[model samples]
Target: MDFSLTNEQELFQQMIRDFAENEVKPLAAEVDDLERFPIETVEKMAKIGIMGIPIPKQYGGAGGNNLMYAMAVEELSVVCATTGVIVSAHTSLCAAPILENGTEAQKQKYLPKLASGEWVGAFGLTEPNAGTDAAGQQTIAVEDGDNYIINGSKIFITNAEFAHVYVIFAMTDKSKGTRGISAFIIEKDTPGFSIGKKEKKMGIRGSATCELIFENVVIPKENLLGKLHKGFGIAMKTLDGGRIGIAAQALGIAQGAISETVKYVKERKQFGRPISGFQNTQFQLADMNTKTEASRMLVRKAANKKDKKLPYSVDAAMAKLYAAETAMEVTNKAVQLHGGYGYTREYPVERMMRDAKITEIYEGTSEVQRMVISANMLK
Candidate 1:
C-alpha cells in the first residue's frame, strides 16, 4: 500500500499553501478581530478556480478530484478556519448535492454558475427543533399550481448571508415523518424568502452563518431536487462528503497549532535554555505531532474512498471523530505551551483554539460520528 500524493496533488497543495500564506494569513487576524467575512479573498479564490476544484470541466469547474478538494480545505484551514468552512459548506454541502442528485436540466442550469462562482451556494437543513433529530423538521411545503409554497425558517445555515443559491429541505407530508422530507433548489431572490440576522458565534466568526426565513416563498416544480420524499437520504449522503471536509479542517487546525508551538518553544528561553531543551515540551510536541499525523491518515483514507466511489460513510465518521478530537486536544496543548501569552489575542493559537471547537460540533458532532460508527459496526 503506497501512500503518497500524486505529482498533481502536490502541486495543488503548494499552490493553495502559497495562496494561504500570501493572501489569507495576512487578513485572518483581522477577519477574526472584526468578525468580518473575507469576501475579497473568496473572489480571488474563485478566479483561481479554488471555488470548484472537484467539479468537472464541462461544468466550469477545475476538474480536480475529491482528494484535491480535501487538500484545498486543509491548506486554507491551516491559516484561516473560517475561510476553510466557507469553501467546505459551499462545495461539499451545497454544490456536491446538486452534482450528485440533480436532473440533467437542473445540473446544466445551476452547476455552471455555481462552479464558476457566479453564484455562491448554501444548504438549509437544521432548524430550531430539528437539529440532531432531523425528522422533527417543522418547515412545510404545500403544492400549488406549477409551484410549491414553502413556509418556515431554518437556523444555523452557513453561507446564508450572501449565497445566491440554497439547497433547502422541508416536509411535504408530515405524516410520513422522515420520508415526508423533500429537497429543493431555491434562489435567494425568490419572493418572501429572506435571510435573518447573522449569528454571533464563538468561533469561525467570519464564516457567514444566519437564519433562513421562507414565508410562503414560491418555487416552480422544476426546483424540486431528486425524488420526492427522498430528501433525508440526500442530506445524509451530502453529509458523508461534508464530514471528510471537516476532518481535513480539523487536521489543518492541529497542524497549524503545532507549527506555532514549535516555533515558540524553539525561541523562548527557560531555566537558562530554550524551552525546546526541556523533555516535557519535547514529549508534548511528540504526542501532538503523532495524533495529528494519525488524523491526516484517516482524513486521506476517507477522501480516497470517496474518490473511488466506494461506501465511505463509516470511513468518514471515523475520520471526523478522531480528527475533531485531536484538533481540540492539540490546540489546548498549544495554548499551554505558549504559557500566559497563549491566552491573549496577540497569539494566533488562542484563535486557533476557538476555531478547533466547531469542527467537533458541525458536519456531525463528535457524538453523532460515534453513533454512525457504532451503528455500522453493530449492524
Candidate 2:
C-alpha cells in the first residue's frame, strides 16, 4: 500500500495550513476574547472552497473526498477550533444528510447553495431531554394541507442563529419510538421559526450555540429529507461521520498546544538553562507529541473508511474517544510546561487547552463513543 499523499491532496493541505496561520490564527485570540464570530473569514474560507471540502463538484463543492475534508478541518483547528466546527457542522451534519438521503430535487435545490456557502447549514436534533435519547423526540410535526406544521424546540444547537438552512428532526408518529421520527429541511426564512436562548459555552466561543423554537412552522412536503420515520437512523449515521471531524479537530488542538509548548520551553529559561533541557520536560514533550501522532492516525483511519464507504461507525467512535482524551491530556501538559503563563491569556496554550475540551463533549460524548465502540465489538 502507498502512503504518499496525492499531489492535489498535498497542495490542498499546504494551502489550508498557510491560510490558517495567516488568516485564521491571527484573529483566533481576539475572537475568543470577544466571543465574536468571524463572518468575513468564514466567507473567505467559502471562497477558497474550505466550506465544501468533501462535497462533490456538481453541487458547487471543492470535489474533495472525506480524507481531504479531515485534513482541512485539522489545519483550521490548529489555529481556531471555532472555524473548524463551523465547517464541520455544515458539512458532516447538514450537507452530508441531504446529499445522502435527499430526493434528487432536494439535492438540486439545497446542495449547490450549501456547497457554495451562499446558505449556511445547521443541524437540529438535540432537545432538552432528547440529546442521547434521540428517540424521545418531543418536537412534533402534524400533517397539514400540503405541509407539516411543526411545534417543538431544540437546545444546544451549533450554528443556530447563523445558519440559513436547518436539517430538523421531529416526531411524525409518536407511538413508533425511534421509527416515529422524520427529518425536514427548514429554511431560516420560514415563518414561526425563531431563535430562543443562547448558550455561553466553556469553549468554542466564536461558534454560536443556542435554542431553536419552532411554533406551528409550516414546512412544505417537498422538504422532507428522506423516507418518513427514518430520521433516527439518519441522525445516528450522520453522527458517526461527524465524530471524524471532532477527532481531527482534537488532533489539531493537541498539536497546536504541544508545538507552542515546545517553542516556549526552548526559549524559556529556568535556573541557569532553558527549561527544555530538563529531562522531565523532554519526557512530557515526547508524550504529547506521541499522542498527537496517534490521534492523527485514528482520524485518518476513520476518514479513509468513510471515503471508501466501508463500515466506519466503530472506527469513528474509537477515533473520537481516543483523540478527545489525547487532546485533554496533551493540552494539560502544554499548560504545565508553560507554568503560570499557560494559565493566563498571555499565551495561546491556555486558549488551546480551553478549545480542546468540547471535542470530548459534542458529536457524541467520550462516554457515548465508548459505548459505540463496545457495542461494535460485540457485533
- Highest-lDDT candidate: 1
Write model 1 residue lDDT over 1-379, tens digit each, in one string: 8798878888889999999999999999999989898999889999999889889998889999999999999999998999999999999988999999999999899988888887898999999999989999999999999999999999999889979999999999999999999999999899999999799998898998999999999999999999999999999999999999999999999999999999999999989999999999999999999999999999999999999999999999999999999999999999999999999999999999999999999988999999999999899
In angstroms, the error of model 1 at 233 is 0.2
Model 1: ten consecutive residues of lowest lDDT: 112-121
Residue 158, candidate 1: alpha-carbon lDDT: 86
Off by over 4 Å in 1: none
The pairs that clash in candidate 1 are: none
TM-scores for all predictions: 0.99, 0.98
lDDT of each: 0.93, 0.91
For 163-218, candidate 2 gives per-residue lDDT tens digits of: 99999999999999999999999999899999898888778898888899999999
Q: What shift in Å separates residue 230 of candidate 1 from its native position after superposition?
A: 0.4
| Model 2 clashing residue pairs (backbone) | none
